[model samples]
Target chain A: MKINRREFVKRMSAGAAVTALAGCMSNAGRPAAGRVVVIGAGYAGATAAKYIRLWAPDIDVTLVERDAEFISCPLSNLVLGGSKTIRDMTVGYGGLAKYGVKLMRDDAVAVDPVKREVRLASGASLQYDRLVVAPGVDVQYDTLPGLASADAQSKVLHAWKAGAQTVALRKQLETMRDGGVYAVHIPKAPYRCPPGPYERACQVAHYFKTAKPKSKVLILDANEDVVSKKGLFMAAWNGPYKGIVEYRPNSELEDVDASTLTAKLQFGSVNADVLNVIPPQRAGNIALVTGLITANNRWCGVNWQTMESIKVPGVHVLGDATLSAQLMPKSGHMANQHAKVCAAAIIAMIKHEPVNQEPMMVNTCYSFIDDKNVVHVASVHAYDASEKTMLPIKGAGGLSDKANELEGTYALSWAKNIWADMLG
Target chain B: MAVAVGCPLNAHAQDANSIRGMAATCANCHGTEGRSAGTVPGLAGVDKTQIVQQMQDFKTGKRASTIMQQLARGFTDAQIEQIAAWFSAQKK
Candidate 1:
């Protein structure tokens, strides 16, 4: 059970020995003191991975991600407005490597906690003393028939996965016929970004107003009104893109005929020259398969302070995968923040340390309604031990009842500062 | 420049001293040991690698943090190891 440091170091450089040691590390978890394996390289996973390495460099750390570069969805909408490109949103993982983290460019397919192993699509198994799962959100395209995620490439572009999907969607918008109709479908609640579809609509309308005057945008929102960042969205859509943007609230898109470029809606069909669909989403399929989500359509349930799965031990869920009634729509910013909360818990457990009795969590979501203005929603969290819930600080940080130039300016500054805090 | 004498993180119990010093600095705004005064943050219980990496990022300019970079730039490799050691061992 004793692994000499020299032997461990010797084994680490050699690939076969690394794997062997990794296996041995899994089986030798006598008292939960060793390497921690983090799956998913999104805000959640990346946040967890970096924290583990920072807290315990002596303990081995490995990050598993399918993509080499991460394109942030936060500032991505500006890409559609011609102010930014996907390249502007892209980030490298070299920061993690510099911290001595092992990067595995492979998809994690499954995990067996009993065996303390994470099986990847590459047929490699990663051993962990403690496992942190931060895979982020997964779209359930099947929620809407004839309009799956694959539809992004052929007819309607979701462009939510970043990389090629984002670029393809941009190209689709770029080559779209001038003065032609462009459409966006807002899915049901708890999607990746609450104000994303609307911000996207505004960005498109910005393009159309300048490039294609005759073109109009039709936004079919499944909800009664804009969800997150409501004031800012209404201000932009109503003030800036007012006449050009046709917003249909509480009207869901029932069907899509990609060939003819038409969307059938509860209200009526809207024919379009180009279509962008943000489909209904839930926790990642990996979470669903692992029973992290419930039949109530909520993601994993957990003790708000610890973020440990109420149903499973040695497994913690963060990001869009958990049901935190305290927070607003799931955003990468929130996910990253939540991952830190969970990380704090994990580090404590390794040394048999007592956790803080009351936990405080925070998250902010920024929406770029237009070039001149951006708005943000923020909140402070308090974990209630009795209720097993994380509640907001009532008057702390929420959207403005009336967004003005001052609010907009503050939001812009807040975003710049927050991004610096999270990804900076 | 000579190292700050009477620095809270003295030679005795280097690990705890470094951890408390790091936490105290962050707590100036983030609250004690990573907890915040509502606006800043609570670093009491966060990812260890992420915290250290973020500090590293701020120090190297990979990420932007005026105060954090200033704070991070002051730490040496041994300090970082000690800081990570103390904070990661904290409970949420």
Candidate 2:
């Protein structure tokens, strides 16, 4: 942001004029103070926690995550297909302790909304003046007739939650035969990273393009097409792994006849040496059992402006768990954006200041097609008057149907810079 | 009666510019103090009051945003607090 050019000088002059026009009466008082407890540590939760720590130092901040190490779902597909490793993607919370955060490594068994206390599995309760929950998304394996659970994940690899399953899936991919058909079974809607399955196909195809050219991939997407950059990924599929990648859409996978080592689909039963099943998903089980979600067990509805739970008072849900009419697809980027907006409203409440009932949101989703090939879709929008949301600025940013040198270079540069932006 | 344009960049930049200067990118999209006017999100207003909690999410990779994840890495706990304190000081 160093503006040294003549253009910069002109802008600075204009900035001075703007400043003079509005007398410099800015934030003149101490910021309101209170302790905030953040649960979960995924994109929305973690981003909210990090920004909270950076922005408010005096307010004692406590972060509770069930796990010690964090592995991301964003680049996780890369690991499954073998473009990246768990070591490369794993993260630690040691840094948060230095920033005045009390980091607790324990499962939050129950959130007592009435008492404003969270009871942990360790039998300890922590009270918070304000609470933030960004637990990310939870997979509803039970929805599927025969799907893998925490106990059965090892037998069949989902590789969706990160950690051991990621390792297991990679191992399975390595052991598959050169000419074997690797089937990737993608579920229906309301899952994390809709573009994820295609990205995994691209990364794996990148591997099979060189290592096992004869090996084939069968993608069973239960949709019309794999979302975002569908055209680009398909073009790559045709160019590099023409015979290797086979994409099948609107083909829903039914019960897995594991005895046959094949997925039973509506079209037909397809056999494979490896089965990568992305079971249907919903909000975390806690969100469902605790009455945070509707009977559908999909998501909880919230006031777009408040992010307050429709069912309860003083309860806010962000990230993939809460249902928003903003039409924001479930992604970490959207969750992070929503978390900040919600946090701002909460802060206004603490300060006893006039809270803006109307707030806008920003979202940008990027998928790494490979080390070089990536696709991004960005939008800038606010909620409409009906309390529903739409893009105010339509088509601010989206993927280019045809890739050029500049788009490729920017996508690569963006990957590097975004990592810097999020966790550098 | 003056408002800071951005976070104090020079406060502790001797160690790692990447770590300390991370939130600045957000300020570009978000506001300088993160009190953005609905264009994107006001990072300072809410998350900061919780302090290092959100940063902890970024640190652990529990949160994954290509931008914020890179921004959160390679920092000590003390630096996380310093930046949170600095931004929380601004107007909501």
DockQ of each: 0.05, 0.03
- Tens digits of per-residue lDDT, candidate 1, A1-424, equal 8989998877765766555445433222234456778778777777777666565566677888888887777778778877778887777777677657788899889888788788899999988877777777776666566664354336777766666767777787889888787888888786787777887888888888888878888888889887777766777778878788988888787877777777788777888888887777777766776666763665777766667877777878888788756554587766766666666667666644444445555555656666656666666565677776777656445554444455444444444433333333
| Candidate 1: segments with Cα more than 4 A from true spot | A1-32, A148-153, A295-298, A400-424, B1-92
True contacts kept of each: 0.00, 0.00
Error of 1 at B43 (Å): 14
lDDT string for model 2 (A189-252, tens) is 7578767788788777777777777888889888777765677778777876688889998988
> lDDT (0-100) at residue B82 of candidate 2?
64
Model 1 has a clash total of: 25
Candidate 1 C-alpha RMSD relative to the actual structure: 10.6
What's chain A's TM-score in each predicted model? Answer: 0.87, 0.86
Looking at model 2 chain A, report the run of 10 residues with the lowest lDDT sum: A23-32
CAPRI quality level assigned to candidate 2 from its DockQ score: incorrect
Model 2 off-target regions past 4 Å? Answer: A1-31, A148-152, A324-326, A390-392, A403-424, B1-92
| CA lDDT scores, all candidates in order | 0.67, 0.65
